[model samples]
Target: MMFEENPPSSYLTRAAHSEDSQETITAISHVLRDQEDTQLVPADDSESFAAPGDLPANPTSPQQRLAKLKLLMTQQKAEYESKIARLEQRNRELQWEIRDTQWQLGQQRQRHRLAEMKIRNAERAKEDAERRNEMLQKEMEEFFETFGEINGWK
Candidate 1:
């Protein structure tokens, strides 16, 4: 009957100052006050929370409200822990991928070095063959001139 006569704001004001009024208020109000004191309010809602001493829309008893809050806290904790685990697993996978990429790059560098060495060796072999051919041609020309002079075939 007193609650019906007095407004919710007046009850909040009385509860703020009086210990007797705090007992009359719901436990949820006390919990909210405790959270505010410790700066640990749940971050589920972006909008402003209901003011302290505000009644639930359905008017549940203090015990029921407290139990509901406990259950909600448990669920949120589990969800956050699961998210952290998934993120850790993804981080490990990324590290493995980086290692594999580095290994492939090393292999490519070794192959490139071997290919350059082969090209240089082939170029050197070609030069040696050309020099040998030139020497043989000179020898054949000298033999022909000597034979022509001895046979009197100016």
Candidate 2:
């Protein structure tokens, strides 16, 4: 944190600053990096990072490592944020779909109820028509019998 507040000028750039001042900045930043790592890796276990060929023999500056770590953390954060956004979008879409389905289901139930009511009404009409037809048939039979007796026919 202190290093960021007063970052050490690069070795290539010098403006009225003594060599001792540059060395002091480098040492302070390095100490800060070590302290930050102490919470994770042991202080004596620097070799656990990488192979000798891959790792620098001596890290004169801590800026490179800090920058790399920052970049990695930034990428991981972006990935998580993107994933969360997609999940939220999907959830909203699913909610809308569920609502639409429920509305359709309600409509279907209403239609079914209306159809059943119509069927019941048609059944009642059919029964009434059948009763009328039976009455007309009985009246016709009695009329024929009376006519036959009046005409002296069987």
Q: Judged by TM-score, which candidate is best?
A: 2
In candidate 1, the residue pairs with backbone N, CA or C atoms under 3 Å apart (3 or more residues apart, or in different chains) clash, namely none
Candidate 1 lDDT for residue 74: 44
Candidate 1 lDDT by residue in tens digits, 1-154: 0112332233333432234422434543554454445333222223233443554444443333454454455455556667888999999999999999999999999999999999999999999999998998898888888887878964
Q: List model 2 lDDT by residue over 10-36, tens digit each.
A: 321333233344344455456456534
Candidate 1 lDDT (Cα, 0 to 1): 0.56
User: Model 2 has how many clashing residue pairs?
Assistant: 0
Best by lDDT: 2
RMSD of each predicted structure: 13.0, 12.7
- Count of clashes, each model: 0, 0
lDDT of each: 0.56, 0.57
